[model samples]
Target: MNVKLILSTFLFGGLIIFNVNALPASLIERDGDTSLGTWQIVGESGVNAMHAFLVSARKVVFVDKLEGNALKRPDGISAISAEYDLDKNEARPLSIYTNTFCSAGAWLGNGTLVEAGGDNGDANFRSGRQTVRVYDQSIGDWYELEGIMPSMRWYPTMLSLPSGNVLVVGGSKAATGINKEAINNPTYTYYPPSGTVMEDYPLQFLAETLPNNLYPMVHVMPNFEGKPIIFLHANQRSISFDLGSGKVVFEYPKLPGAFRNYPLTGTSVILPLSSIDNYNARFMICGGNKAYEITSEGEASCGILDLMAENAEWEMNDFGGTPRVMPDATFLVDGTILFVNGARTGFAGYRKGGGANALWVNENPVLFPVLYDSYAKTFKPLASSIVPRMYHSVSTLVPDGTVLVTGSNPQGGVSLNVKYPTEYRVEIFSPPYLFSNTPRPNIISLQTFEINKERIKVYYQQIVTLIVQVAGGEPSFKASLIHHGFITHSQNMGQRFVWLDVVNVWMDTTVTDQYIVTVLLPPNSNIIAPGPSFIYLMNYDAPAYSGVEVLLNEQPA
Candidate 1:
């Protein structure tokens, strides 16, 4: 757990410090007791949340299907969404004219949430299947852009590229029907329409995946040879696509078992990249079900891939105790993965009749959240939630250490008569790190702050100095830049975490109760893609984070 920073002069102008120590080895193991955290019902969301994203440190926006009866404001406008303030524990209705059902979103470099695609609705004007909406946090309102997507996307995925543009990929052309071979839109296109529309960029792998391929897990990986390569997963197949030239680079081995998209939902995360390994990237996916097994139990299998290897192959692991389908696998600030929500049996969606397990056969919700340690390949159970998060549930890591968990609408509508009724209540889960007795590091100021601009911009390979006040012993600080991607259908697109290197750490001689830490930004855009990321400072304990916008400048100044 002890990390020592070694400074060395390199050919380049800036100092090249190596972080030889591995991430705290203690995080690899866990105690026998499962009660390591606490969960509390924070507030009730007025609308059934189908989609949710963090807008800021203290605010979150929730979107739902445009069912006729939407949450209304005082002026009687149909509010399709609501914004919840974490500080006040209050929810206020935000008017959304479009149907955002099954939509996907990613944050732009300027901190705007660029949401794309949706359901067709009841053939109404508000049906926003091809609409592109942007939510500006400063104004606290939604703006429907004049530009629309080339095709209708129901369960699409969006990822922010290092070039500061959003890439829209893989969704059904229609809204209501199940994902059929003919209805799948396997191609991808950029937002703001990339000039010539290259229709049907033949991705045959998508069609082969069939009904379970909706909302394929996608990640904009580190640039390979200066060209951006995207990793796409549907069913068990993993393929790499070259964004620059728009061609399939290569296809890796199929995942061990079970499909990991839509009805057969599981979850995935791009394992944290470390400087020690030259920032090599790895991807891990866990928990799902067989597509045809409507009432069959979920799978406990997990698959990992080292993308940078010469011949990358998926290594399968089954360390988790119970089976879980549609679970939300989120990466914590301290470089660990957390699995929450989902069911133990059956696939996604609610069944009407035919048997006891029918009418939402996916019962037995996994109450406790499990933590996966990539270092030791172990699983540790954490605190459980009172509310059952099913088909349309979401869990997002907020600026503070706690995770905001909410939403579960198994049935078509909000009906209490069903086995798993619609859920609107929100709960927050605090990890054990948040409850530690160690004093948290306070970031008094950043060296890159400019008086003219409201927010600071930390360029690539830039050395950022922080003035901190540590209450505990000598602080062993680690910086994690995380983008909490769009959470829906057990998939988080563009979600990644990278451990920043600490160049120097020393106590300030002039000031009392203060210290100075110099951290290096990612070397290039390939390591950490450009966009809005939460820079979390982890000292002796898991401390809160502040938002920093990243740009794609590769050259170091």
Candidate 2:
């Protein structure tokens, strides 16, 4: 331990206040070279990024389970959360009083980040099964309220409802290899919950999809008959539930795969929406074990469906010749999907029970990433990484076009010496667009250092003009909005992307290489649920170096 680091940490309020390493050296020297869709090891994280969410363009918040990590709390306990700096590649500790293992989170419509649920913790680790923690990016700390959740949840999915509150669904009481009837918590609840025992609504779909039904996939579909519906996929089944009456409205065709959730996990994402298609949503789920019989090989195919159609059915396709389990599906600014992390064999979770797969459920870390182009309807292999981002790993698309990847611990706790030890490295993947010399657009009008405070507010059926500039010359541009939501367990709950209708674009006489781009916002709140999101400009297929944050239907604070 560096003596300077010890001097940085001292007893304050009977707790240890650990300051920043300020400039911890990265194991790899980032030459700042543009490899074009390459991976770069930037820095290490204070906590394993089992769960993470981008707080701002320059900052990310990483949370893990109460394991034996290297960073400690103000009280000399293992730190399970930290604020990661994307610009300086530095990490600073954030105070978290509860266990966040296998938890769920979402950004409220008001732009507050809320976290919920976790498993029982050790003596030092407080029970987080029913806690709710909200993050203030400005303060860089978590304010937790224990026993606030209606139920004890371990792997529930947290999604933002149309009304601005978060809906936490699914998960179990205990950490079981596969869900069992006794421990299965097949229900959903709200953040500022209704004051009643009946606040937690029962969802029979969860109980029916037993065994491998942890972190059940749920996405808010477009409004149907003036009410919102959520699509839930678990095991091999999929269904649409009406939020108004709490009933399964439609049963879509079943997905053809072994299991799409934990223990053998794949990943799912809602494709980019556009007015040309009336914002008709299409969802895709890719990579997992193909069948129950095959445990060592991952599912080589993907399933997609037009979820809002009257006669919706799943269409399957190959996973670009790659087999993956626990892969992270991230939506990029250029309307392409990037699948990274996970392994080629086995399931999620670490070595547990007595079995051949007990040593580590997963194997052969899928080092290479696959890119899915929705327009071309094809998958392409991209550059590979030297690290194995297997179980508990997560990848997040930052404000910058690059993807920040972190975490991979296949153990009960932090272990340094193992085939796949707990990983603290934070790497960035630059997409191929960055490598090309193609001109990229910059959102010059979006000038804000503060988060939602300075965000451009978009309402229903509104048209907004963004001043975009390109160095090479004036070029055609398109607009898109992405809300990455909370990234964990490959779900990235509440994550959505929409194509903003570019009504008009014309060169600006006042500024060279600058254009006034007018874009039509989503027609209604259903098109983009209320919350903080990112607005991106694309010069053909190349996205701007970074995106600017915007508030979608977020009321004044």
Candidate 3:
């Protein structure tokens, strides 16, 4: 049976809605082997994915730079955007006026995908610097707002704030090897420009980091707008900044070993926050170049910082002997970190080959995918893919518990003949949990709303009862809320997985094979940020077959 698109039907209310079986595509029947899980060339992405995010379970919106993609628009221009259908395993081109090269995005609380910034375009492709585009479901396309941003930004990072706005931060006026003082954009601005607190607030931290601070790893904390703290990691240092005042809340100890932001491109994700840990914030950064100019191998270490610890200090873990440069670290539904993609050598840059051009950093694609058990602090190597996903490659967890992996254009301009050419072939990585003997959990409804028919507004600290069905499993149920944020350059901008506090779980007296689970959404939007969140019901240790997408909010969120 085919996987379904629940988010499309329930939230966006789009035209296409697949029948959700609440079960993952069982690899036992389709793929000949299931030991290392399964990998299949599902389909071709019409555009090379410089940016991608799962808009729904059945569809992914792929954004590319204005390049020589084989897919063309209605007017015959090379299309830079496409909507990929996971159900059909095919992609259809969508309209995008500006180039989205090296751009970043975050999902709004209202379910809008707002993407911003890009490089200068040629005569045909319009420039995207200072441009902002939001996905419009009504038109089934993108609505571009050209030059509306306060200033020009090339590779800015965006994060959804608790207040339902997107914060755009730190890019450069123009693309460079490492950001220079003259070209660095050391400030952050917000979209919706109407009720923004600060516009283009100059951040000295961005300047202090200099040369290597492009696309800083900025995450919204549970600081909640009253104090409002955002963790910013760039170059070798990390800082807690007050978004309200542009002042540093706390400057952290400098991370040793390698630079983890742009060019070097180490990936970091705010680790899954659990109630057991008091929802204390923790960040895990993995795989970056030891030096800006090294092509030998990346730093084989991963760093963890506990924000709420008594005396917060850096804890580094040695990545399973093998080093990586641009690996993507994503949280699985089963509460494990899946580190996939990226090359074992080189930085994140475009080049015909390696070492010749200092910025040329693409070689040796790391075929193996590793899962980091945060609880055990050990890495388990999973199946390796045949495709080489480097440079602009991206991966995100879907509703059916599969990792949708696609895109890699080391040299750029979309050529298929070269060694590591622009890769459009999509691959789905099914972790071992899917094929296990454990029973998969299912979420039936949220209050009055059914699984996939209408939008459900879940508020902060509200005890929402989930009607669930599972036969013969441990009564201990857990709820995992996730957002597959805009993924590009090893940064899943705004990607978050917050463990909902399950208050109680009791077998349903009225219905057979059913149970009533009560979970309190995070106290405020700060914990998970206010936006579209996927709620997964976990049965004991096994993963959920699929998730129910709901708009998670606080006040106006």
Q: Give the Cα lDDT of each candidate.
A: 0.74, 0.80, 0.80
Candidates' RMSD to native: 5.0, 11.4, 6.6
- Estimate the overall C-alpha local distance difference test score of candidate 1: 0.74
lDDT of 3 by residue, 238-265 (tens): 9898877768888888897888888888
* Candidate numbers, best lDDT first, in rank order: 3, 2, 1
Q: 281-319, model 2: which lDDT tens digit per residue?
A: 898988877544325798888988998788888888988
Q: By summed lDDT, which 10 consecutive residues of candidate 1 come out lowest?
A: 9-18
- Per-prediction TM-score to the true structure, in the order listed: 0.89, 0.90, 0.91
Where in model 2 is the C-alpha error above 4 Å? 1-36, 194-198, 290-295, 352-358, 447-454, 554-557
Q: lDDT (0-100) at residue 323 of candidate 1?
A: 92
Highest TM-score against the true fold, candidate: 3
lDDT of 3 at 526: 80
lDDT of 1 by residue, 318-339 (tens): 8378899989988887878889
Model 1 residue pairs with clashes: 351-359, 351-360
Model 3: lDDT of residue 92: 89
Candidate 1 regions exceeding 4 Å error are 1-35, 68-70, 74-78, 123-125, 196-200, 351-358, 448-454, 544-557
Angstrom error at residue 513, model 2 = 1.9
